[model samples]
Target: MNRILIVDDEAEIRESLEEILSEEGYAVSSTSSGTEAIVLLRDAPYDLLLLDIWLPDRDGLDVLADLASLETDDKPEVIIISGHATIETAVKATKLGAFDFLEKPLSLERTLIVVKNALEARRLRSENLEFKRQLTLETTITGESVPAKALRQQIKLMAPTNGRVLIYGESGTGKELIARAIHSESPRHDRVFIELNCAAIPEDFIESELFGYRNSAITGGPAEKRGTFERANGGTLFLDEVGDMSLKTQAKVLRALDEQSFVPVGAAHPISVDVRVIAATNKNLEEEIAKGNFREDLFYRLNVIPFFVPPLRDRKEDIPSLAREFLRIFGREYGRPRVEIAEDALDLLKQYPWPGNVRELKNILERVLILNPHVHRIERKHLPRLVYRTTGRRSDDFSTLQQAREAYERDYILRKIDECHGNISRAAESLGLERSHLYRKMKTLGISIRESVS
Candidate 1:
């Protein structure tokens, strides 16, 4: 429930407001002195404060000034109430962060409307704060490799500018995260950050999605809808997989970038927007341009500042940190907070070439957490067979013959078990060994029967 505090010298007025507000389903508290109201605010949080200008202990405006100095997340929205009506006092109250001003003869309907609006405004402020916090957490770059450090430095240098950025990376290398980091550090950080995946949308509807339609522009669509360009006005617009955009859409997008204005479908007038464009693509745009698939002009417009994000294989040294970060993330998500990875398991992770990059590693960790709910510390045996089986290591990669022999045996045994669909007796029979001997070999190789089967 929304909490309201009333600070007025008049006992009759305070009691009446408290009763009315309480009946309206609000938790209301009344105090006859501004001093006591301040004390009450310090002790607890209130959504709205109804303060009277005429106070017995202190001036209500002075109390509002004091509120400015109070450092609290749950600061109340002030609604200044006064018997003496003056334009100057209302302006002063507004300048001092008062949400609204009310006269001596408060209308029940007006008071209720103002109170509701104040509470709603406070709720929106809280939500916006929470959203920014989450965005910061999600966009953090979690690696200590040379490439990772260079990318961070580049973002810091380029984010403050209005130049267009084009990110080049393999799929799942975190191009979108880099875009968001740039937007968060940019001058327009307070504004909206809109994203549209060019490849994900159908070619037939890409134009309409980029520049929204008006008055049933499509057959059965809404009457009027704003596009990403319009929604991202005075902010940043990220176009992911820009290489996949058709030549026809490319022409219109180029014009929009040049003119900073575009007419929505079925609309007569053009809407101008101040938006910084950031584009990302996995395919080589230069190759696409040469192949006559992508437009050269659009590529030039978005490639003002180019960023290359290396794939996970190139940054193998960061695998341990990345693995632990993923573990922490999925652990908290799955309510398994103290989960830890063994060093040997991390070594195996670093050996494998991540085909799906960071995204694949994250999925594997989450899967491990979900499948092994009782396990606190993740060991090599807890990992899936694919992780150790398909490492694709050459004999020279191993320092000793024993290491090479053990790796070969581990792969061969896993293949047999997999071929038998994880049947231990059948696998042992095919290998010309007893079930107990096979189990002993698996234990030596750090392979779990349950993991292989599951």
Candidate 2:
């Protein structure tokens, strides 16, 4: 049976919540003091907590701040109850990690509905998390080269520790893959492994996105949400492209890293989380620090477990193994019969300086498989023109010109849609295309635009 805890100073209120919840087949517990609530919560497991914002002996927000320090997975979902709450206090409660803010004149019907929804949501979330973990494929280093073997060894050595890690590598060098590998081997393997690309989000949204904001925290903001640190509690948080983060945000992250707690964007109360931090970057951070673009102090904190991912060019010996693996996967995915890459073609792949790293190799192999419909064994002659050249640009002289154009156009449309707020009409107008024509193009390209504002 699901468990519920009611923490209200008013004896009548606590009795009401407990009687209502118990009638609905829930295991119920009640407390009138914030101090006793904290003790009970620490001692036992409760699925949900009904917290009062104001108490006789202490403020209820302080109890929430205390609950936020929980180190166990059984931390209860908190719903704040208040009789005289301002919008500001409601938002502050939300930022302090309250699941929901409820008014004091609680309608029995509304209370039951909210309580049922919160419990069901938690059940669904837990189910989805377990389902995702079961479906995810395991990542292997897939190389026998010196660098690859050394990296595997280093990960084995560092996976058990709680030290913060800083990974250095070029784009597509499998930094994320290595991070996941470490997580999989670590003590926190069963927990979540959250990732955020620091470069992908804009400067203003970065703070709110990472630390989250309460409802209506900023001028015309969206609803309350949990941030990365909170979501990754008791797990690992991988910060990709950490060099791109602004120095101001870096300082805030540094403070949270040190204290394991932080105030949300517009809330006074602070929430604490226990998250293992793993940061990755492609830029020379030393140079960025010298130029005052990166934080020196944050760098030292994250660099406790320094790791350097070898670029594809430096680990050329791994190319053949990686290439074969990609070919096998793509061959099955593209519905092509079994195929093979000749020795000469494999040698040519090794000769090329893969500036895009392993990602380029995977994409190129997929293209080769799709383009070679009749050839079961890929030869050097079947490779694209850009593969052997210094530049990736294709002239009209290439045979795969049409295929390359369609691929580029598909990518361009996706980017335009993101920039246009997922609005097909806006994206079409910006791209100088008629609405109907753009609709047809999107259908032909297998693109689904959900925000179809007419």
Highest TM-score: which candidate?
Answer: 1
lDDT of 2 by residue, 66-154 (tens): 99987875477889999998889888878887778678788899899889888887787677776665434445677879999999999
Worst 10 residues of 2 by lDDT: 445-454
Q: Total backbone clashes of model 2?
A: 0
Instruction: Give the per-residue lDDT of model 1 (tens digit) for 1-454.
Output: 9999999988889988999999999999898988988889988988899999989889899999988889887699999999995898888889999999888788989999999999999999888888877778788888989999999999999999999999999999999999999999999998999999999999888988999988864576589989999999999999999999999999999999999999998888999999999999999999999999998888999999999999997898888988888888888888889899999998778767788999888889889888889998999988988887645665555677877788888889999999999999999999999999999999998888887786
Q: Global lDDT of each model?
A: 0.90, 0.83
At residue 194, give the lDDT of candidate 2: 98
Candidate 1 error regions (>4 Å): 1-133, 217-220, 394-399
Candidate 2 segments exceeding 4 Å error: 1-138, 217-221, 390-454
